[model samples]
Target: MRNLCMKVNYDGTEYDGFQTQPNGNTIQDYLESAICSLTGERLKITGSGRTDAGVHAYGQVFNFHTESPIPIERWCLALNAWLPRDIIVTDAREVPLTFHARRMAKRKTYRYSINANRFPDIFHRRTQAHHPTKLDVQAMEQGLAHLIGTFDYTSFASRRSQKTNHVRTIYEAYMTVDHSFSRPGSDDQGIIHTYITGSGFLQHMVRIIMGTLLEVGEGKKSADDIPFILEAKNRSKAGPTAVGHALTLWSVEYEENIKKH
Candidate 1:
């Protein structure tokens, strides 16, 4: 058997999530179906990680073992023909049989977008979280700065998570504002983009962190409160989970030696 890795991009608005479900409406389900149709074998594909319902991905990666003789370069083209328009296989490559997509992931970056205008942008309704109130960007930045370190993030994770350890190393966390997409002469301030890169993330961790920062921006919580929340280790200590539609799995990183197409 040979292991083949592929990079996938999808708009998650219409699916349950990334993982396969009994209902058979998921990104993984479509991918596996496409593969089975082309290769005539039922194969299970392993994703880097699960993205929650309505959370999109730009560079999600997955791998599967197959005995088909199909050339590696044609996988992208063949898969896209069978997959839905919203989901596309962008790149494909052959990898060592030992390469496991989830286990080999070194870092994952997620981006959360917010529309802080009085009126939501019609074009970005499905892609951005709409928050009408004015936000203190500087305060939000200060709060995010406190998350850049190894810590037990139980406070930000969902109680539903079955993972025993909540400790994860956050290598970078920051935010940026962009007005290039703003309408001419409109009073729109801009879209706020929050990015976080880490070794791994617990279920709903990024969304909860974004919600807490939103509270800081609204002066409901002080930037200094982040440390206290981190130490509390209680789920109730953190802010509400932000909407999933605004969050996107930006990219996944692995060692330099991993071949890419």
Candidate 2:
């Protein structure tokens, strides 16, 4: 058997999530269906990680083992023909049989977008979270700075998470301003982009963090409160979970040797 990896991009507005569920509407379910149609094999595909319902992805990666003689380069083209339009396989390649997408992932980056305009942008309604009031971006930046080190993130994780260990390393966390859609002379500053890279994340971790940061931006919380919240180790101490529509699994990275033939 040969292991083939593919990079997928999807608009997750209408699906349940990435994982296959008993209810049968998910990105993985559609992918497996397409694979069965194209290669005539019923097999499982392993994703790098899961993105919650309504959370989109720009560079999600997955791998599956197949015995089909189809060339590697044709995988993307063939899969696209069977997959839905909202979901597309952008690239594909053959890897060593031992390459496991989830196990080999070294880092994952997620982006959360906020529409900080005075009025909602209809074009981005499905992809961005809307916040009408002005936000203090500098304060939000200060709040995010405290999340850059390894620590127990229980305060930012969902109480529903089953993981016993909440410790995770965050290599980088920051925010940027995007003015691509800003009007010429309006007070609108455009979108607020929050980019975070980490070893791994807990369920609803990024969204909870973004929620707290938004509180800081709105003066409901101070930037210095982040450390105290981390020490509290209580989910109630942090802010509410932000909407999933604004979040996206931006990219996943693996060690160079893992990608080598």
Candidate 3:
């Protein structure tokens, strides 16, 4: 059997998530079924990240081992044929037999989008989280600065989450907007996109951080008080997490050597 690494993009609106669940339809289930249908070989696929329902991905990574003789190009066409319309196999390729998609991943980038308008737009409503209050980038950036180094993030993580270690080092976190109003259908509705890219993330880590920043923007929480929240070791200290619909796994990066022959 040969191991293969695939770069897939999916709209998570219709699926449960990336991993295969007992009964729910998932991205993995469709990919694996497509592979089986084309190659007549049942292979279980593993993904780099397990996003929540309604969460989307542009460059999510997954790996599978199979003895199928289907060409890499045909893999994409064949998989897309049987898979649902929302989930598409953008790229398929052969990789080292030992390459494990989840374990070998070095870093991942996630983008959470928000519509700052009081009235939500009908067209992009599915992807952007709608919030009435104007989110100040300057204030939010201030709170984001507080999340910069390694610290005990117990306050920034979900209380019921199964993760033990609450400490995580954030390489970088920034909030920016695409101000190009020249594009068609560009009302310049103000899309607030938070980009958080790091070596690793704890459960709901990015969402927690986004909530904390939102608090600062709302004036309910002071940017200067961010340090105190981190020390509180209580999840309640942080603001409410943004919905999964706005979160998207942008990409995964890893060492070329780890790609397994």
Per-prediction TM-score: 0.97, 0.97, 0.91
Per-residue lDDT of 210 in model 1: 97
Per-residue lDDT tens digits of candidate 3, residues 1-261? 788788888999888888888986888888888888888888788899788778899889999988877677777777889888888878778887878888888878898887776567688788888776656678888888888888888888777778778776777788877544224564443778888877777778888888878788888898988999999988898888878888898888879765422
Candidate 3 lDDT score at position 108: 84
- Candidate 2's residue-wise lDDT over 93-171, tens digit each? 8888999999899899999999998778888888899997878999999999998999999999999999999999999
The weakest ten consecutive residues by lDDT in model 3 span: 180-189
TM-score of 2: 0.97
Q: Model 2, residue 133: what's the lDDT?
A: 88
State the weakest 10-residue window (summed lDDT) of model 2: 252-261
lDDT of 1 by residue, 7-81 (tens): 999999999989998998999999999998898889899999999999999999999999999998899999999
List clashing residue pairs in candidate 2. none
> Which candidate do you rate higher for TM-score, 1 or 3?
1
As for TM-score, the candidate ahead, 2 or 3, is 2
Distance from true location, Cα of 157 in model 3, Å: 1.9
Task: Please list the residue runs of candidate 3 whose C-alpha ends up more than 4 Å from where it truly belongs after superposition.
Answer: 180-189, 257-261
